[model samples]
Target: MSLNRIASVRAVLGISLTLVLATFFFSPSYSMESRDNSSSPVAGLRVEIKQTSTSPITITSTVVNDNDHTVTFLVYNSPLDTAAPSIGLLTITPDGASEPLDLPKLQIQRQWPPSPESLIQLQPGASQTADIVLKDFIASKIAGKASVALKGRWDMVWNKQKDDVTPEMIEQAQLQAEPDVFSGSFASESVEISPA
Candidate 1:
C-alpha cells in the first residue's frame, strides 16, 4: 500500500480501538453486573450490635445495593432453619484476640420479611438502612478492648428474572429447590466495651 493509505488505515484503527475501550470501561450496567457476581453484593450488608441497656441490645445494619437487580433478605437461625424457635449466634472476643468467648444464650429479633412489604429493588448505586432490635441478649460484664463477631446465615434470593423467564416459574422452582449448604462469617468489628 502507499504511505498515505497506510496512515489513513492506522488512524481508523486507532479510533475504533479507543471507542471499544471506552464502551467497555464507561458502561455502568456492565460494571455493576460484574460486581454483582462477586462478594461486592454483600459488602453493604453490615450489622452492628450494642448493649443499650441491661436487658436490651440495639442492632443496626446498612444494606446497600450497587446493582440494577432486586434482592430479597430473609433472617433465620444459625445453622439456618425454616422451622420455629430460630436463633442467631453472636460471639465476642476481648482485645482483638481470637479466642473462645464465654457467653450465654441470647434472644435476637428481626423484623420478618423486612418492611415496606415489597421486594428491594436497587437502581444503580442505591442503598438503604435496616434497624433491628435485640433483647435479652447482653452479657452481664463486658469491658476493655474487645471485638464483637456477629454471624447469621439468612436465606437471600435474587428477584430479577432472566431473559424470557417468568416470575411464576421462578416461584415454582424455588418451592422444589434445595437449600444451599454453605456457611461462613459475614461481619465482625472491634470495639471498646465499657463496664456498666
Candidate 2:
C-alpha cells in the first residue's frame, strides 16, 4: 500500500477511537450527572446490636447512604409486601438471645423525621443513626457475644422530578404523578451490647 494511503487510514482509525472513548465518557449512564440520588435498594444493609441491660436492650444501627442523592428513612413495624401492597410485623432477634424480638409492641423514636413519621433525608456522604429500645428484650451476659439481629422490610421513596424543578410547584405535581418506589429487607445489625 502507498505511504499516503496508510497514513490516512491510521489517522482515521485514531480519530474514530478517540470519538468512541469520548462518547462513553460523556454518556449519562456512565457519567455522575445521571446517577440516582435517592435511597438505594436495601440489598445488604449493615446491622449491629448491643446489649445494655438484661431487662431492656438498646439497638443502634448506622444506615449508610450509598446513593448520590438524599434519601428519607422510613421505619415500619411490619414487613411491607411489594406485590400485594400490604404491611405486616417485622421479625427482630436480640444479640445472644435465642428468641426473636417482637417489633409490633416496641416504640421507636427519631429526631430528624419525627416518630409516628419515620422520614429523614440522608445526604450523600452522610449517615443517620437509628436507636431502638426493646422492652423485655435482654442481651447476652457474655462479653463481646451480646448482639441483636434486626430483620424488617422498610419502604423508601424519593421524588425524582424535583431534581431541578424551580418554583417547586411543577416539581410537586411531577412527584405526585410518580409512584412511591418501595424497597424491602431493610435489615441491620446492632453493635454488641454488654452490661454497663
Candidate 3:
C-alpha cells in the first residue's frame, strides 16, 4: 500500500478503537432499579409498632429486598432514634385527623459527609431490621387509634468513600438539608393510643 493509504488506514483504526473504549469505559453504568418503582422500597417490607407502654413506644421495621438484584440502603438514625446523625423520616396520623403529622426534627448529631459505616448493603432475598424508639413520635394529639409511617429517602448515593461524592451529588441530595433518594414510605398497622 502507498504511504498515504497506509496512513489513512491507521487513522481509521485508531478512531475506531477510541470509540470502542469510550463506549465501553465511559458509558453510563447499568444499575438495577434501586427502588421497587412504587413509593415503597420493597414490596415485602413492613413496619410494626408496639404502643403498650406510654412512656416509650417501640417501633420495628423489617426491610426485605425482594428484587432480583442487590440493593443498598442508607439508614440514618436521627437523634430521636439514636445519638448519631443519620437520615430518617417518621410520621403519625391521629385518630380523628386526616393528615399524618411529621416527626419532630432533632438536632443533627453528626454532620456530613457521612462515614462509610452508614451504608447498608443487601443481597437479593436479604433482610435487615431497624428498631427505633417512638418516644417523641407519638404526640398527645394522636388520641385513639393512630397510624404510623416511615419514609426513607436516601438510596441513590454511590457506596464509596466521601471523596467519591461530587458536589453535584451533594447538591442533588440536598445532603445538608434533605434526603435525595426516596426508597419508599412504609405504613404500620393502626394501634390504639389511650388518652393520658
- Over 1-196, each residue of candidate 1 has an lDDT whose tens digit, in order, gives 9999999999999999999999998799678656555633344444454444323333344445444554344334421222211243555566656583655554656554334333344444555544334333334334454555456653444433223233454345446742221123455354344333
Question: Which numbered prediction scores highest in TM-score against the true structure?
Answer: 3
Cα lDDT computed for each candidate against the true fold: 0.46, 0.46, 0.51
lDDT of 2 by residue, 80-170 (tens): 2211111223244445567754334433442432242434455655666555544432233233344444556554444332232232433
User: Who is ahead in TM-score, 1 or 3?
Assistant: 3
On residues 1-196, what C-alpha lDDT tens digit does candidate 3 reach at each position? Answer: 8999999999999999999988776555412232223333344444444444555555555565665555554545421233211233666677778787644566666446555565556666776665555555344555566766555443343333334555466456754533334344444555454434
Backbone clash total for model 2 is 14
Write down the lDDT that model 3 would get: 0.51
lDDT score at residue 72, model 1, on the 0-100 scale:
43
Candidate 3 residues lying further than 4 Å off, grouped into runs, are 1-55, 77-88, 136-139, 155-196
Clashing pairs in 3: 153-181
Candidate 2 global TM-score: 0.44
Candidate with the greatest lDDT versus the true structure:
3
Q: After superposition, how far is residue 91 of candidate 2 from its true place, in Å?
A: 5.9
